[model samples]
Target chain A: MSLEKQIAISPAGELAAKLNSAQLPVDACYQCKKCSSGCPLTFAMDLLPDQVIRLALLGQEEQVLGAVTPWVCSSCETCTTRCPNGIDIAGVMDWLKEEALRRGYSIPQVQISRFHQSFLETVRLGGGRLSEPLLLGLYSLRSGKTLEKLKSGELKDELLLGWELVRRGRLKPKLPKKLKGAGEIAAFFAKSER
Target chain B: MKVSYYPGCSLEETAIDYAESIAAVAPLLDLELAELEDWNCCGASAAHSINHTLALDLSARNLLIARQAGLDLVVPCALCFNRLKVAEKALPVPQENKGKTQPPVKVWDLLDYLTQPEFLKSLAGKVVRPLAGLKAVCYYGCLAARPPKVTDKEAYENPGNMEALLRALGAEPLDWSYKTDCCGAGLALARPDIIDTLVKRLYDRALAAGAECFVVSCQMCQANLDLPQKRIAKKAGRDYYLPVLYFTELIGLALAHPEVDKWLARHLVDPRPLLKKLGALSAFA
Candidate 1:
């Protein structure tokens, strides 16, 4: 059977509509492969950038969500800039990641997801700014992998670098002074939860 | 020219040197940077990926602050600039502010300010030390000049604004392919292996082009390239010693300010030797 014959048209059309509403024109992508060619992390991704778009256009949401490409994308926007169709491929990748989170799919790249949560928590704690030490500490604890490196002393180089940064006043030991409108910022996050 | 400045989160903490250098060089170029008071984070990569509405609201709050100030906003961090600029375009007008067809305020990247012919002309006469022929490559990274639609830069793919500023500072800007390449940005913390690979490619190309150092505008790029070059070099089994400095820091050095060293000392990879070699340091030093 032809690959086209294998796909269900109804679901594919529905997925395309959903993606269009999110401002990601996956249907506009012509499989030029320019996005994949320009993506720096393609070597590490399970599927190519172009493949992700093609699968989404075909409404293969489970496969697309399960793949590691969306989670690993750094949102560099190189693909979006280089796309001949101007499809905002990077934005589509972001949408895929968001959908994966919403649908409760397990992220293939656990570290990246952990870092994102830790980063947002750090922002919330700082009332907007990032506290470097706090972010690193929380990320280490939350990820659990960094703690393994720490226990095994494999992170010694990172420690030395941290000390050097401290000496030069780059990394402060204290938490950042929270912005005055913490309540308002917290409320915005709370509203978004709904 | 007076503009509302948004230093974002990194500038307040890890990238304080970037903020210091910008302040140090602002007066010489006749630019007055008034930081936006009570400004919150732009949500950066964290919020945008997780919750789109939250990202829009976070950046909208900051833009509203700038709108009320009635001054054009200047964002020094590329990531923050991208977030704010994207928000300005994506957010809908609230019911209270509907039908206000015009954009409330314009967002300016630091390069947008420095690249102006008038600003460059004014800055040229203020150069006490003209970088003394230092060969440097301009690294735009991703956010400041990419996804042409969001940034609306004409030369997003091959931007020459940084090169123009380099020439004004009397440094030789080497033309390279990785100017707008990604440096792994926030992923630097999550995936060092990926950053190692990416930074290695960048360093290899810069070295091949005979660049003594890199001039960057993004705080994330500066952190990734400067802090990890040594480890990346070791991993790649190449002897690389390139120093990455913020473009503003170079301006601070060329201006021959007494406090320039204080700003230089904050880099993980020391940039003084490169500065000294090029004779870019002031006689007073």
Candidate 2:
């Protein structure tokens, strides 16, 4: 068995690229670990916010891409605001989420990427954003597990939430009757994907 | 003056008092609330935790909906206001990756909309009886002040703007420790155990600092302090209660409406005792 771990990039080169590119201050990360110290959900993460930034700066892209922190970061920005050096760790985490997905890395615990993608797909399909049908679809998909959780025996709970929105006049059934650049924006996201 | 009103999800349900208060005070301020039609949840804690872009998109869509209505938004809920402001900050920033998607709208906070000079001037003249002697502790929870990127224009730790607004309404605003602390928001839903601790910590600090009662701008915060605090205290085996008033409710009382009873009567925690102590509660049978 091989005892050595694979490296993502040579540390020196990665640090140089990060220094030039990342808006967060690499030197200001004071190793105090305040970010990890304050995270409310740290128990759920394999890599802490401070550690992800540290690894990214260290050119450990393989380690970062494989880690669970990026997917779990709520972008609460609690870690960033509490950082003594004012580093935007949450922004870095957001960057990492996009990067990890681009690299085809998956997080098992986060486990809801497909559901979220469905929401975006709904937006793309409408030529703009619409929440009610999109969320109903998302909820129905989620209701599979939610039903099992309901020993309380109320599957209509989800439907009731939707109906409540309707009663308040907050939810609507129709998409924008017409939009000028709807086709253009959808085309833009589609082409950008390529 | 016209303002786009974004009464976040809780307003229609648990925090209806806040909606009532906003409605009561809006006419007095000569402010017109053009409600944003077909608005969705701002995705405060859940969507943000589960999916980042979806959260931003949810908040941004509300903003764009307001923009489509040709009005900038006003939110009475601090969490919704903060989420909208954060989404606004996130939307304009160019992402690094070329092929990745982003949310398609910009967002703004209620404070951001209300603080505009002309709007503030309109609110100034509507003060009828001015809460002369009440010393209010302006409680801005973590949601309203975090993410310095979103709160760049407003000072996060020192949110004296609420104080300034209170002062303008002729009430003295107290500087207190629990001003920006968590009010155990949605934790009351999924994690009631943790809320007992967070709520007590918040109320204790304000009581110690000599605050008459808490004045808040968030429905979630108001719910925790107003209705749920008694249960929280009971869970902790402590007997303590503090009156939490919406900022709009204070302004409403100061204006001396005939309908003040309806508004004050709606509070799960009665504010009449505190208002009478402040010499502002009036002759309403």
Candidate 3:
């Protein structure tokens, strides 16, 4: 008799599989569904916590990979704590989100993603996180066509907060030093990409 | 003393300065950081609120991993530390998660890690340059001390560890009211509308406390306090500026240990003027 062929999984599927495998002892899942009940953003998810896991167990790569549900998770640990199964749902979700993004799927986090992208981009360029310029730049960029729509007086009001901090002894702006272990951090992210 | 170190995402990307300072000072204190291999996110507030078990599993995995690796984990980010601690407690409790192990590891926040008397003594012994007269507000955002389940390491934990650490380095750690206030962590994403209120509160409080500048352990806290305030100010029609220094930068400054230019000067909102006020320029230079 011919042996059944092994199914080839996409990067996300492979990631899910790796996560499950690495997440061995996940069999402890009691299915109490505390994770589902506790989640703040559960309503926003296309596939709730348990479904994501069930799909992951079934090795349903396409659905898990293509789903934007993973990115919607804010890496909050609400479900993981309540789960009797002892699964790191947040970690798994994060892994899935990272994997989905790696596979070239546009799992847009919308506003949050934009915020993350802008903040991280600023960090990537400057080597350390910056607040004022990052906010100004991101808000400006996000405003796009809306920039003109914002009343000049309102724009001035907003810009003045940062200016006030700068003027007072409160917010002092300076180049925050970068980490010596930056290469290690970069390597970790790079490895995750692979 | 050997401790496991979990430098969360921000420590790698946005809070690099803190990393650089740790690299410089860890050896001086004879404090060894054994970073766990194959660690995952600690599932900060967002993940925990989404799925409690998953969050515990993520942190438990790290703890179990750390237990297996033969060291207690030290997390630099308050959020990561808090999340992991919450998971550690909730996972093993019978009423909480009980009897599960996917990801396993015990986690400690940076302040807790350094507050260990032995470690503090060691760091104090190795201070080549003291902080002298520098005054800084110990800004501990809500993540480090609030939400009892997550930050159970201490009863009524104060953000004074950094201040104490600063004092150990011969710098003055200011007593400030905004130490445990919420810096509106990732809220800048979902609720940009209200972040100004949160950011401004922290800024105003720190200033009112008469701190020369603010120092924080979390990258996100610094970002929220430093970056989003501009927008919040823009919205509030007020100018909000506070030099948010990574605790490590202050450590480097106090100890006269300037290793990385990027680490010393990487705030998106420049901290030079504050440094000048603190009399840290020549030492940094």
Candidate 4:
């Protein structure tokens, strides 16, 4: 066999072990497409939910971690709910997101990851609570979508929606109110520094 | 009855109307929502997606505060409710404080707490200005009940809690297929295209059910369903002027709360004209 075929056929088994660490019953998924059927975000996903699990079961760590399916997963829990074998597919998706980050996989769904990073950054900096204006500003800058839109002269779409929200007192453009338990929240962040 | 209330971060701004609507109708049901002082965000989907332990720790901080009050906690946001409950479940007691006699705290979504048997009885009695002709579908976007294991929700698939509550207030709750379906709330900002798709599906389904509006419990659901109407309309070649509302706002309207008008005004697609048409507006308004 050629080197490419040998590598593709080899079963590393580490990815499956990591997934099953939480008693996820990763081995028990019997190719039931119930998860795939119920998943709402599959239209945007490169691999279906069931297909992602199938690859993981086959120890295809590169294919599983690098897939767009995990990043686009809305964490809606539709697959988890329908899984007859009781695999936490949504939870697994979350794990895959975390794992992808840890392994430095080039995320195809870059904006999605940036949005999540913005959320965590907002909570940490705001002393616990997230500030909406700050979140949008951070996400806009971090994702580079704002700059892209600005260059394309297409930023008006988001601006119009934001202005509408502002009219209704929905999106406030102020600093978040600092909460009392900053020390502990900071400590939690420090201890779990990823 | 008194309960600790965690309004969560959204209530502070985007969904302030939901908070006020709940407050507007709280007194009629004799419900005292003692705010959980100095509580923080549950870290929401962001923390959970990246770090599970941090997510649990964030909500655990709030759970600790709730445990101090020794009261059942009521969370107004569906996402917060799920995050807090997940926190309580994961770290039932603070890791350091394990084996100590800490008072257990039961976390409830605001909708769940309001629809409890005792509360429901009081709510039924307080429906003075009934929303007789108002037609809206109860849209329970995911997180309030999902995964079954974390939420422990018996009625995840076809939850009728909101419908039952709306009926007590004399409004017709329309039946729709996507009641418990995902609205792509997690992808609201990151991928507007996907959110528009998911939300448009909901709008189409709700309108096809002969409904005039979307009654939502989650603020994310309300925002997703409400904010994208113009864009969705342009793309679909149809106008969906469906007014998305907080179920509490409808309750406030049915109970004749004065702030109902103010709450209705905050929504992007105004439900006031719909209310006027249905004769569901407060007399003072």
Badly placed stretches (over 4 Å) of model 3 are A1-194, B93-106, B157-159, B236-240
lDDT scores of the candidates, listed in order: 0.85, 0.65, 0.61, 0.86
Quote the B-chain TM-score, candidate 3.
0.85
As for candidate 1, its clashing pairs are none
Fraction of the reference Cα-Cα interface contacts (below 8 Å) that each candidate reproduces: 0.78, 0.08, 0.04, 0.88
Tell me the TM-score of each prediction against the true structure. 0.94, 0.66, 0.59, 0.95
- Candidate numbers sorted by DockQ from highest down: 4, 1, 2, 3
- TM match of model 3 to true structure: 0.59
Between candidates 3 and 4, the TM-score winner: 4
Q: List the residue pairs that clash in candidate 4.
A: none
Across residues B125-167, which tens digit of lDDT does each residue of candidate 4 receive? 9888888878889999889998778888999999999999989
Q: After superposition, how far is residue A78 of candidate 4 from its true place, in Å?
A: 1.1
Identify the superior model by DockQ, candidate 1 or candidate 2.
1
2 or 4: which has the higher lDDT?
A: 4
Q: List where candidate 1 sits over 4 angstroms from the true fold.
A: A1-11, B92-104, B282-285
Question: Interface RMSD (C-alpha) of each candidate?
Answer: 1.2, 6.8, 8.7, 0.9
DockQ of 2: 0.11
Tens digits of per-residue lDDT, candidate 1, B1-285, equal 898999887887679899899998898888899999888877888788877878888988898888878788999899899998898788654344455544457888888778789988877888878886799999998898777788878888888988888888888999999898888977888889899988888988998999999999998899999888778878778788898988899888877878888888899888888787766764635
Top of the candidates by lDDT: 4
